[model samples]
Target: MCFKCCLFLASLAFVYFAKAFGGAYMKSSITQIERRFDIPSSLIGVIDGSFEMGNLLVIAFVSYFGAKLHRPRLIGIGCVIMAAGSFLIALPHLLQGPYKYETSVSHNKDVNSTESILPCLSNHSMTEADDTPDLETKTACEKAAGSSMWIYVFLGNMLRGIGETPVMPLGVSYLDDFSREENTPFYLACIHTVGILGPMFGFMLGSYLAKIYVDIGSVDLDSITINYKDSRWVGAWWLGFIVTGTLILLSSIPFWFLPKTLPKQGQEQSESKSKSTELATVAEQENFLPEENQEQEEKEKPVTFQELAKDFIPSLKRLFRNSIFSLMILTYLVAVNGFIGMITFKPKYLEQIYGQSASKAIFLIGILNLPAVALGIITGGFVLKRFKLGVIGAARVSISASVGSFCLLAIQVFIRCENAEVAGLTVSYQGAPQVSYNPQTLLSQCNMGCSCSMKHWDPVCAYNGMTYTSPCLAGCQTSTGTGKEMVFHNCTCIGEMMTPGMNTSAVLGQCPRKSDCDRIFKIYMALSVVGSFISACGGTPGYIVLLRSIQQDLKSLALGMQTLIVRTLGGIPPPIYFGALIDRTCLKWGTKQCGGRGACRLYDADAFRMTFMGLITGLYFLANMLWGGLYIKIVKRQKKLALRNQAKENGQEGNGAVNGHANISIAKNKEDEERTGEESTI
Candidate 1:
């Protein structure tokens, strides 16, 4: 490649990296945002889908028009817009007051014991004068009610979608146009490999940040009641956005200096000379036109707006006429739907099913999963180039990878942990499944005299393996230590549930599951890593098929159309619907301080695993069927074309031999006739 081409490729790669970083960070922070906003999974899905909504609005027009305009500059402008969106996403954090998490502990130091304090309890001993709220207190309470700030996050994500519209279509088309035909795959692979790194870093950043409290610098660590493992814990999610936005802004700068077009590397000079020579040779051989006239015709032809407008529909029609390209789009559409949903919720799945903290799940995905994907992409590209695989070869590779990955995913359905044992939700205080959803069931006979509220969900795990909704429900009269370290003593519920010789005590935090669940999680992670690598191997080849199947002129439009279809159908809906289904598996739901249902605290693991993996597996299986049909067609078409070309060459050679033999026979006859006439005259 020329220096300029190299620079443009680097710029494209950087842009890809920056965008992926921001996008992945957004995905990783979904759990944190859910807790921070006290929103359900379904609502979070809508917010996640908003980015695709923005892309859907402008992707087609941008890709079509951007092909004709200055592409690099358009991409640069897109990056700026993305940066703005990122900043906007973080705006709520600065504008809103400090985050307040729900807890059972009182803020006052004098309240040593929480035994007397019940959820929504009011002291009737107070006089009417004490019951009245002051005007200042009322005003402060009203001002603090800013939980609706999640709207900013949704708008910001949508804006990000708009900004990302140009990057893929424009960048890929630009690289393909300027680079050598064989080199295009490797270049794209490189870009994607670098892009994959962004997610790794982004998720890692999210993991690190999730361990830190949302109000770390502003709040006292000693006063905090919840750890990162707590369900209600909100992390420093906004900080990653700010950092990502800045990087995206920087990535846009290089594109401004790049030219709109660059000469094709290694062939620019030779191609011009060869074109002129070929034209002259053809003219002389056919006796058709003068060399000067041909030269004049070859000179620059200015394209007008009218001509471009007229050609647009015809170009689009020509593009879809190819059956292979259309099938590729359909197959890709299904695959993407599965992939997007899986990646978006994988961390949450890990957290809920395996009893992992959000931080740990995000960290493992970033550290292990993304790197494997990156390697797979690069390796796929290498295999293509090393083997010099044509269309058929690429298709076969893609199919193999898909089949292998699908099998792995299917196996995942069988490997699962048991559902969490939460009191009053999944199981009763007596360690039996509670099929009914009744608040009254939480008020057991053991703690009925304690006056505990059924609404409170501050669970304390007793020594007997059964958990209580709260220390008060456990009928604990006293507590030791404070914050997360606090332990409840003289627990009546524990005594009722425990065996004859066991101690009657309970501690803060929910009970941990069996140790075997951890072993299952490790096994799941190993299979996940291998499956990710195998599945990602098909990515580059699949993309190449899309690129090569379309006409060169329609390359941008074809890619844009594919993106539009996939984003609209796959990208926009999966997160929403997947989230809704996963929400069905939530065994226990958290309660907001302002009085409404919040994010899910726990899920039925077996149900969650079955739902998530089953959906992905079904989508992949359907996609594989489409791919098989496409492959068969491709192979049949290639065979027919090969036979036709061979027959044409053979016919031309036979005709040339027959004509030569006839000329030789005619000359021999004429020589004999001349010799006979001369002899007779003598």
Candidate 2:
């Protein structure tokens, strides 16, 4: 039995691991997906939130009815569905022939050709008709828009969410039902611990994959102009889905063989009345009952839909009537809003605000931050179990953790890096940094005759520590080697900024941030790690408060309702609104192949930092405020319950003392009467 139970646990853990890995990998690949599809952050946010919408559609039904069904088989079915969804998410990569990025240069031309297509010289010959795209291009653009391959990813992710709903509620309840009460927590902890490792490996996988080109085998890597660090780079984001999907499929196999139910663990030694005792009492009642009573006993039937419907409303009311439970849900909802939005965009934040590559950002989060969270969760559970904290005690622990983490998070707003020096965006053509610029500002004396297109975003780094929007914008009239090694000679704009006798050539790609930004990034990461760990330490304790505050019989309903409400409201809206707000800070938007705005190629670093961090901080502040109120409510309720119990105990003791005195007096009176009767008789 123990071995079988262990097998079940191992299977469940593997399923948990696969799902978590897939989810994290999806988040880690957000930037890649955004670039691949040429979509805005707000649209990507919608795709990300689709998973929650799917869960919202089916969570309530699954939570209530799934327990009565064969839980293992149900979980197995969910896994298969999740696997299908994973495969579907990868379908877009197969359908979309190859990613085509906007560029001004012709890579197909020979590098050794004597005749060079100089961007600055060539711009003089471009007429009005040449600027407008032809009919073929317009038709292709219409076709691309009609296809909208990202819908597949959204649907696949939604399916994954729907499938995942059954795993947590059913699996946890099943384990609790069959396992010994003392061992349940240990089992759950083991599963969660193993589950956390999935995200670690998932992010690591994402980091590794992000360094490789998206169309790796099909395309020539040598011809690609962008490196992994470039904003336009698209990694093999779809591959992780296939790998994780297979794992989820394989994880489902063991569940089919497991029994629907198991004999309660340690049932033989259990002091409480067991199932067999109840059966024996029923047998005795049947033997002694009258014929009509026997008939009535026979009329006992299986529970029907109407009975369940009748019970649900009152159960819901009972669950919500607990003020602590309602407040806990509200606090969690507010906290989760901050958490979801922050995590979804944290990689983007690192890349824009701190000058970290997407790969490096994901790698750091996996190795440094996620481990801290794992440790914090373990510590929280240990502290709660070791100290055996009650509802009020748990609330205090969560509040302390929240306040500490909030302070640490607030400190991070000041730890920021300066904006990157990009020509025509953050800086002028003459090397002067500016807070804002218009499209006309991209033109200057050096590049005015060149007529550079502001829509194109082929960045080139000049010798004078400045980045131009393109070689033409830099007034470069000379050739480049090829791809990443390409460089332009006689850049007029670069010469204006350089000292006399200095070379006026420019290299491919934007210039990296200054060395001091690296130091700032490291500090930001350290503070982030500390804050994440501190916040995670409150997770398990806060959960315990929710569990303790609700009615025992309505525990499942309460949990299900909480999941539905929090996920529907908190999970779905945060990303959309956060992404929309962040989009306002885009310094340069990428141009699509069809002559429309694409994903943002560059963001205003200062604005991006303030917006992203400010939104997260404000949400956390509100969450902390809610947590404070929740703590106060828990304390008040605890005190009232304590006082009420004490009064009841005092009243019972007083009544017992009065009854004892009355009995003693009655005994004495009987004895006195007996003595008087004896004297009279004498």
Candidate 3:
């Protein structure tokens, strides 16, 4: 039986890992998906929130009713559904044609040699129709209509959410039911610790896949002008989804063989001997009576739909009556809102604020940040188990960790890298670096001869370490070399900005940020790692608080309700609002093939940092405040429960003492009667 329990734990752990892998992979691909579909961040947020939407539809019923069924089989079914969703997400990539990036490059009649791209030489001024590629053909509009393929991704993610509904509430409740009370925290911690690895590998997979071009096999990589550093670059995002899908499919197999029910660990002897007293002792000590026991009690009476329906509302009422649970859920909800929003766009933040490539940002998160989180989670569990912390003790540890991390997180608002110095965006066209974007400052007398279209984002760096929007905008009359190796010569803007003797040529891609920025970036990452560890240290303990505070019989429904509430209020709205706000800081927006506005290519660094970090800090502040209230409620409730238990024990002792005295008095009377009879007989 213990062997079966161990098997279930191992299987559930792997399932946890698989599901986390899928979720993290989704988060990691945010920027890639955004660029690939030419969608805005706000739309990406909607897609991200679709998972919660799916959960919203069916979580309540599944959590409540599914607990009575075979949990492992349900979990297996969930895994299969998740796998299907993953595969569905990858379907759009195959269905769509090769990705096309907007470019200023054009070939000559011979097709081998490149033609001059000097718009300055043309007599006619360039118009929007001339620069817009998607509007050139009616056929392109038809293809653009298909660009709503993001809907498939949305639905797939939603399906994944629906599939994921059972895994947490049912699986966790099942484990808690069968495992020893002392062992539950460590077991949950082990599962979560293993689960954290999923995100690590998922993000690492994202990092590795991001370096490869999206259309790698079909097209020659040498022909592509931009590298992964380019904003327009779309990586192999679909490939990771397929890989994760396969892993999930494989993880489901072991769960199917697991039994529907298991005996409570460490109580098998009492259970086998059918000793009422021993069973009663174990039940009395536990906060929640396992579902198996409840089932055995009700097995003789066939349950009806009306009875089940009747109990539902009353069960919900009993759960929420505990003020501590309600406050804890609120605290968790606020914290999760910040967390989901922060994570969904964190890669983009690193890429934008720190001037890191998408691949590098994801890599750092996987290698540095996620491992810290894993460590912190295990540490929290070990601390709880090692210390054998009661409710009050657990609250102390959780609150301390949260408060410490919140303090560290607030410090992050001050640490930020300056915006990339670019012509027209972050600096004057004359090569003076500035802090804000001023589009009107893009045009100058030096490049006045060239009426370049500002629509396309083909960034090029001049010799003076200034980045122009494009070679045409840089006033480059000629270009040499091809692809990523290309260089622009006869650049009037560079010459005008630089001294006469200095070089006038520019090269492909934007200039790397200043050395100071690199130093600042390192500091930011170091703080991020430390802060993540601190924040995560409370995760296991905080979860334990939630698990222990609820009534045992309602554990599954309580967890499910918590998920529903958290996902609905916390998960659904953060990303949308966060993205919408972040959209306001855009310095440049990518143009879509359908002549519509697409993804944002650049953002004002200072405004972005303030907006993003400020929101997170504010949410954390509110969460911390709620945590304080929750702690007070927990302390008071525990004390009250302890006092009530003490009073009951004293009452029982008093009755036992009175009964003992009465028995002694009866024995004395019997002895006197026997002595009198002996005297008469003598």
Candidate 4:
């Protein structure tokens, strides 16, 4: 039953992820513009990045305030917004074709503008045979409708970004709220596992949406019945989205099923704010109070946001200054960046250079990634408990940075697969060099992009009874060595591309195959392994441990606010800064520019140098820093704060006790004086 609940949520997540999948499609369309519509690559990034346009502001505000508002509702909102974004992505395709009608507005006001300013597509390197968006050149059609259609699609996705931003944390919190009684490790594992499958299943299932068919006369996988678009695949994915969203929303109801009992994340804030307001009102009413009484009354005033922002003054005074927080944040930032970077290289580098289809390789990577993460998490859990560690110390920000960076180092080798494969294949053919994807024939079962159509076609590959004919060409390669003799190996994919022929798995052989089919199995594996491991070690564990640590610290709202400040810093884009450097140096490195794929792909020497070097440098900070460099400062600082706080409490109690003792002594002296006076009078 717990598994069912988890799977249900996973389905929902899968649906939500369709937006991401759709986003990938949108990128494909824009890339097509570069190839077909004659748009530039620069413009494509702009258009794609626009989907996440101003996401930082939204994500930050939403995450912070959403906690301050309501948890479940915010999650629901996130789902709605993400779905809308996914739907908007398909709008351009739906609107494609000649429109005879004109807009109702005078002066030609339309629903969308800037469509003609197309996001860039393919570069000039591709053979002219590649199909690109065909812009109607006839002047007569200018008045009918313009690129505004595509622009609408772009703008729609941009608007949807706001809604998509909150779904993750909010949903997790919602799950946390509901799963209060479940075992922590078991519950968390369920959530994490489902969360991944949600999006994946969404894409897989959504591909077959409502049996809807697209009628494009150009091509079909394997060239079988290629005249019409197939609806079954897309229908499945659409159904996935609706089903997942509906179920997630429904699952959330259980959290709200019983009457509200626990204090909401916001109640404490409201209470604190109210106290502050009362104190301010009283202070404003009078300029001064009697000296003896003033200190006593002032001590009762509630802490305010304004005063606390300055090094958390009152908290510091009370010895609530937590240095672990700082250490954790630093460690988390570096580790995540390096680790995410490492896995990303698989698809970006392997597929880009070697032209291997990403599906097969990425899948294998998952098998590897999952175990590593599970192991890491279990290991971390043990380490944390044994060390008497708090959440910040045990989980994220405190995470051993080396795991990620070292993993990245491992990632560097796989990227060479593309180069190795191309060199191996070409060299093997011409007697120059050799290569392999490690698990040879791994491509045999991979159907990712290698002609989804069961039928075999496309001259790029030919089919035997089971697999395709000829060696694999691998669309999104791991490597491409064009030196002395242009050696190539590793059939990144020896399978299929959705061509206008039949049995796409067949026919398309050995030639630069699996076109535009870079799956990045290695990246997926690394991410699955590393990302899961990190989350277990830091991400989920961090959330889980937060409550425990807060309890241990005996901090109320004051600590919470500091935490709020800490969390808000995450959305601040080092990515933009990273992007800035990429813009500066990526072009110099050659193909596979510093875009999404750039991180994963290791094509050129410069790209290799930049990415791997960055990986190494960042890793050094994450692991070593976590283990010793950063952690020492953290441990010391936490100890200091803890000691200081303990001392202050002791001092306050001691002062009160001393004052009581003095009052008692005075009473005894007065009684003695009265007794002596009575004796003298007698």
Candidate 5:
């Protein structure tokens, strides 16, 4: 169990630095966006989405292929590729400096300083004026002028994704299979939990590194001035992306020790020997066993890769052709992530319109929205556990969340945009606490009627250039206009972050109207937390459920290839389609079109308000519900068919029945006694 725990941590460590896991891809993609690529936002989202789209299939393949080659060799090669891709992502910097020598610094930490010392060895000359400040800053160049070169970003994701995908399934499966010998789900869960933590920590760590670059590393390379005060408390905010990517790449190295292949030799030998003895006894009892059957029983046969691959393809086909299996896949896909479009794009929308920082938007994304999502899963699980929901339960959960979140997301979009009243905007003489009960309390000088509610202090918001020390006003007044601006005597912005220059003050804006915002915010936060937890809970279990459903009624079907196909198509298509939708919106909107996203657009204050809004929301949910019905019907039919076949197979084992039943029953009595009364025994 302990050994398995170590292996899982190793797998997670690799993913953490490699940036191929969880939100690391999103953060990295955001970096590319910041760097200003020519690619459309949706296209970028699609590419980023592609990292997880075919992950399961990649896992299955790596396990199969890694077994044929050396597992360690495959892992090592993948890591090297991942490292190379990471380097390419930082290429714009390398190109402005030295490419060859920079490549040599793959294993070195002093990479930035090394290049400065070797100035004569620069591979490319700088084109920007000395006053340009940052020669590597993509903003200096046209956004798309070098956006085509952003393929480096895409490749970075691809290489990292491909290399890390297999670790989850194979690694967990490895622990599950091996640990069963000692009776431990503890190891499996522990290892997987670590995998989950990797992403969170990776982000925190990367955010830290990003600050170091701006504050420490960039000092010698660029002409930026760094005052001691700035260095003492600055968190530039880029720390999360850079540090996460760097650490994920470095940490992925330890998966080298995990077992590559299953204990196939032992299982094969046991099966062969056990079957041989049984067949010989049967023959002797019959007094006339076939000589050929006896010979076949004693001789083990080797299956070639060509034969194995051939069988795997048909198995996959049979699984997919089964109506029930197909339904399961469809329903599950839509249920949990059908509204992925809303989830992914919503953040971008908030950032553009409200001028909200990414952190603030992430915080504002309303908790309850996600919680409603969790309740759906728990409801589905309840029906399954208590009412035998089976595949039906899974379908119900998926369809419900998919359809429901779709609607709720539309409402969320509306509240933030169309219905937003600017709700008494007043500047604070001093920055207010993130959570406040009184709106007017933020700006104490405001003579407007108000209510003060929160009991807290410390500022996370700063406007313009000056800092005001006076107490703020608190209010609950109704605004007369659609928008209102309150001026401050002088408000200064303070920057603090996970890294330097991070603008930590944003975290201080708890609830704009603590009473109202908190009411909405709490509900929203609950729902969102619920949603993420619920969705996460369903994912692996749901993956297993759908996989099993495909096999049912498809008796002895080859599933290896189907696993690859289903995982690839299911994961890839949605992101592609979602990205496409966003891009189309971008083309029609954007004045600036940051990376073709229609960024900071006029209509984004209300994206779905245009003609097809309701219909699009309704239609997405409606389709999800339809798939749900189809899934339930299929799962039922498959189970019924599988059982019928099972009965038929049992009937073939006749004649030795009476004596066999008596001896079997007697052996079971002893077997039960020997194994029982021990809680820890496997």
Candidate 6:
């Protein structure tokens, strides 16, 4: 490759890294944004889908017209737009006030001692004029609570989708056009290998940032009631966006200086020599054919818009007519839908199923799973090149990896941790599975007289191992300590345990599940990493199959169309539907101070695992079925073509032998006649 090609490759790699970083960061921060905005999972799903909506808007037009335009400059413009979107996403963090997590525990020392008074008694001394909820107070509170800053995140993500339009189609096509054919796979693999690192780093960044409080620099750590493990905890999710945006802006600069096109490396000279040799051989075999040369030149002429428009329908028709290509697209669509849904909610699933904190989940996925995937992709590409695999070999590799991954996913369905023993949701106060759910079920005889509001979700784990809705619900007569260390004493709920001389105190936190659950979680993560690695090994080969199946002229359009369909059908809907389904499994919902439902605080683990893994497994099963059929078709066709070529070669050799014998016989006859005439003259 020339200097410009090298620069273009580097620029494209940088853009890939930037975009992947931003996208993965968004995924990693989904839980934080949900908690910060006090939105439901379904609504967060819609916000996530907005990015794909923006992609749907301009991808087709950009992909088609970009081929005729300056591809490098266009990609640079896209990077700038992406950077702007990232900045927009982070804007809400700057504009919004400091993060205030929802908590029922009073910040005042006096309020913390309210248990000294009878639980049912209202303290006149505590009531003040400003504390009264007058009409003005209500209105002002509503105004402050109604801050719809989440809209900024949605719009910013959408802008990111629009900005990302040119990166894949234009960048890949430009690279393919300039590089030697054999080197294309390795080049792409290197780009993707570097690109995968972006997500790895992005998720790691998310994990690191999640550990710090959202108001880290401004707030006192002692005053904060929650830790990173708390469901209500909100981290500095916006920081990664700003960092990625800056990198994207920097990545765009080099592309501006790079040329629009570069000569194909090494192949141009060889191709020219081959063409000249073929023409000379043709001239010796037959008279020079000017008409054929003119026709070949005409075929190479640049297509006008009018001509292109007329042929557009025909081109599309021809593209879909290829059975292998169409099947590949379908299979990819199914696989993408499953992959998108799984990745979008994997962290949340881990939190709910395995009783892990969001930070821990994101961190594990970043450190363990993403690197495995990156290695798998690189290995897949290397396998393809090293083995010199054509379509059939690539198909086999793709199908084998996919099926192997699916089998591991199936195993995950069996190796699951049990449901969390949350009070009155999954399990009864008696520490047994509940047959049915009712809000009134929370009102056990122990604390019904305390008049606790079921809406308040201040859980306290009693000495008996059962959790209560709040310290008030636990009928705690006294309290000690403060913040996270605070404990409630003389709890009536623990008294119902009927244990002789047991301490009847409850602490200010949810009850943790058995340690066996943690062991199960570790096993699950191990299986997850292995499955991810195996599945990702198919990615490069599958992509190569898609690229090779299409006509060279329509490579950009084919890729653009594939993205359009997969993103529209797969990207936009998976998160929405997955979130909506997962929302159904929520056992406890958080409440906003402004009198509305917030994010889910707890989930039924069994139901969540079943739904999440079931959906993924079903989609993969379908995709594998399609792959099976595609593999059969590809192998049969390849075998037939091989036989046909072999037969043609045999026929050509036979004809050459006959022609050689005829030339030798004529030469012998001419020599023999000359010798006879010379003897007669003598």
In terms of lDDT, the best-performing candidate is: 3
**lDDT by residue for model 1 (351-407), tens:** 888889999999999999999999999999999998988878888889999999999
Q: Rate the local accuracy (lDDT) of all candidates.
A: 0.80, 0.80, 0.84, 0.37, 0.40, 0.80
lDDT of 6 by residue, 555-603 (tens): 8888888888889888999999999999998777887656557898888
Which clashing pairs does model 3 show?
A: none
Count of clashes in candidate 6 = 0
RMSD (CA, Å), candidate 1 to true, equals 10.7
| Residue 50, model 1: Cα distance from true site in angstroms | 0.9
Model 6 score (lDDT): 0.80
Stretches > 4 Å off in candidate 5: 1-35, 38-40, 46-80, 94-147, 172-192, 202-242, 249-251, 262-312, 332-340, 353-355, 362-414, 417-523, 550-603, 608-627, 638-682
Give the TM-scores of the predictions, in the order they appear.
0.87, 0.89, 0.90, 0.50, 0.55, 0.87
State the lDDT of candidate 2 residue by residue for 269-361, as single tens digits.
233668898677557756775663465454344556676677777666666666667887898898899899999999999998888899999
Candidate 2 vs 5: which has more TM-score: 2
lDDT of 2: 0.80
User: Which prediction has the highest TM-score against the true structure?
Assistant: 3
Task: List CA RMSD, all candidates.
Answer: 10.7, 9.7, 9.6, 16.2, 14.9, 10.5
Span of 10 residues, lowest total lDDT, candidate 6: 673-682
Which segments of candidate 4 are over 4 A away from where they belong? 1-55, 60-65, 97-160, 164-190, 199-327, 339-345, 353-355, 365-398, 401-415, 418-536, 541-630, 641-682
Please give, for residues 492-588, the per-residue lDDT of candidate 5 as tens digits.
Answer: 2222112344432211122222235435544544554554554444443353344334322222222323334444554455555655554443212
How does candidate 4 score on lDDT?
Answer: 0.37
Ordered from best to worst lDDT, the candidate numbers read: 3, 1, 2, 6, 5, 4
Stretches of model 6 off by over 4 angstroms after superposition: 109-142, 267-311, 647-682
Per-residue lDDT over 212-237 for candidate 3, one digit per residue giving the tens place of the 0 to 100 score: 89988998677788899999999999
